[model samples]
Target: MFFIMTISNRKKQYIETVEKNITKITQYTIFNRTFRHNDRKFHKFLVEPDLNVLVVGIGNGDLLASLNPAVGVGIDISQKMVEFAAKKYQSLNFIHHDIDNKIDILKHPIVGKQKFDVVILSDQIGLCDDIQKTFENIQALCHSNTRLIISYYTKHWEWLLKLAEAVGLKVKQPEQNLLSTTDIEKIAELSGFEVIRKEYRQFIPFPLLGLDIVFNKFFGTLPGFRRLCLRTYVVARPHQTHEKKPYSATVVIPCRNEKGNIESAIKRLPQFCDNIEIIYVEGHSKDGTWEEVLRVKEAYPDLNIKAFQQTGKGKADAVHLAFSKATGDVFMILDADLTVPPEQLPKFYQVISSGQGDFVNGTRLIYPMEDQAMRFLNFLANKTFSWLFSYLLSQRFTDTLCGTKVFLGSDYKRIMKQREFFGDFDPFGDFELIFGASKLNMKVVEVPIRYQARSYGETQISRFRHGVILLRMVVHAYKKLKFSV
Candidate 1:
């Protein structure tokens, strides 16, 4: 009973200490302001605007207000901090509750039955006595689509942070949980959350005459240097149980000069789902591919096949045209060259339909390819670009140039809406989808497919020419994704 009372008293003291220092901790010093601004910028990048956002441990409510959430709710342990935030940010809802000890936060009258699209726990997980329990408690306020962002300072910066606090450069507070990124990941898993991605930011906590921007954006983002970053974030979602459903699939085959493979493409593709629609967008093929498409459609009258002559040039244009006409729930891309066999498309369909992944990409590099499937120079280029792109996109991509990519029609529409952001620069059509998926924070999953040598068509890829284009796209992505403010 004595030990129990001591624990209860310690909790009360922690709350009181935080409540008393609310105003002081949030004071707008130049250094404090810079840190907060950088943090807000990073959070804004991770979270899309116009979302229903719930900010746990919202101190002074500045971060929540900056996000401009559609429905913003801020919760904190200290009543004084909550009251202060409520008075300042009248537009957003604020609640005072102990996340570690209290009942479901959703049980509060103000937030009843409201599920958030994004749940932010910025630097708040450290304040919880039981981080796992805190995560479990917050799950009540989330839906399957909700994205939970947890940010905290890395332990490597503890000494520097303490020195700053001692010298009055930053706010000093009670002892925190101070768990490592691995510890936090494990705790989140225990609390029924699956981590999507991890990001490290803010190598220099204070702005030092614009060097902060240069170092943080370029030098700090390097693979080795990122480990020493002051701040780390883990993006997660509620662990979901996916069951296969009867989702209709639209297989869009963008053919350029594949007359020999047109009929074979139709015959080999199995009926993977109940309602399958095959769209063939012939891109001005010199080998009579368009004529073959027409003949195949006439011959296979029972199959739901639609053929169209592409009005524009390049594979990207043809793909965009077919995607616009796609009628099924899911959209699939199968290159008419027949390098990635049409038979393996079922694996792609199952992944997307079963909710195993949001953006399913075929990886030809995983399985042993046929001897003549890929040229030596092209194979080396693919390997190099795969690693480079995976780093740039924050997702594992084994084969970036794979023609067999699958995603939902709804997601493809969302990508189309934001096409202006990246511009219609990609002629090959792969980077557009890849970049769009990364921008939308979609889970990119790769499926290994046996790459077969083309039986009829020659490889259209010009190593030197397309290699330059890929390099240009990499530069553009760095500017938009990593280097951008």
Candidate 2:
């Protein structure tokens, strides 16, 4: 009985010693150690704007200051750490709360609401005796939108980490984790968060017995190459966004006088496109384009429908007005003339869903088109532009003037922000998406959709008048993105 009592007592003391060592490291080593300038490693860990933030293991408060000014609070079990951070960033809120002492991070006012845009564990996670429990407490503070940034000592550093511990120097490490990259991921998921990005920095993040500080400086700039990348930095968010079922797309058809075509276009659209809401932008025209769109929308109430007028005369202007009303993960433009049919829109949707490319474009020239639809002169112009663009972009651009185009709405917003760089020159809107796609480096997938000529209403394109403008826009794109810095 005495022998068992002795062993139990020793084990308890041993655990206490490890806990004390961690608290000391949490307060001093992370915050007190600073470079001539701020540590670039810590600064790079901050990837997003911290509109509202919480520092889970607020060691030295160094990480908090580097981020965008945010309403933030920091908590550390160690009183010394709370005092240190308070003294440094007087503007910040620092309080002492032990992770193991029934003090969940989520219970804190700033965290409980999960209102933070970013929640940082930083090197603070290294000091925990129970890394998984600490991770769960941090996870509750993250909403579906929050970004959690964390890093910890790799298990491969066990020898050096033990040496640091022996010398009474603060060693930040995962709790006896022998942690591999996969281990980190499992723990994050168990804690109700999903790892979004995992980046390995370098093999050796610190100065070794043989390698000099100069080698460390060189590895820092190499960004790509390195051996002992110390710890992996994980950027994780809640997996709920990936789990939500995708919604069907909104297809916008801009109609002028294509009356004979509407009923067929409505029927031929694929079954997956059943939930597709078709909004027709009807510009003022002599034919009953408005009445025809109303007829199609009535036939398919399963497709939520809205029709509006385009005061401006161009297709580009019509797309701009139609898009203001679109709500879909995928936004597609279909010409009402059936040059590009509604059936082809499903392939575009599938291309995006399969993650083959962000933007799907229709290529009319891939297979020969109906001869009557494209006149001999228009054919020559299309061929010339296709060859020129393919050469310029170093990608197979089979057709540059095809009216049908498809893309994700979010990516479009990014491209649109800089649209003024290429002034609104193309009335067709084909070059605008092409130019934006080239600028964004978006993988452009050309789906071969059959093109048939309009059986009614005159073709809107003015070949001779638009040809000079198309040539000028290509020159402009070359100067702005390709040849310039």
Reference-based TM-score of each model: 0.95, 0.51
Off by over 4 Å in 1: 1-11
The residue-level lDDT of candidate 1 at 348 comes to 91
TM-score of 1: 0.95
lDDT, candidate 2, 156-179, per-residue tens = 777876777677564433345467
User: lDDT by residue for model 1 over 288-319, one digit each (tens)?
Assistant: 88899999999999999999998899889899
- lDDT on C-alpha atoms for all candidate structures: 0.84, 0.65
Which parts of model 2 have CA positions greater than 4 angstroms off? 1-245, 391-394
Task: Please report, as a residue range, the 10-residue window in candidate 2 with the lowest summed lDDT.
Answer: 1-10
State which candidate has the highest TM-score. Answer: 1
Clash counts per candidate, in order, are 0, 6
Report lDDT (Cα) of residue 257, candidate 1.
91
Candidate maximizing lDDT: 1
Please report, as a residue range, the 10-residue window in candidate 1 with the lowest summed lDDT. Answer: 1-10
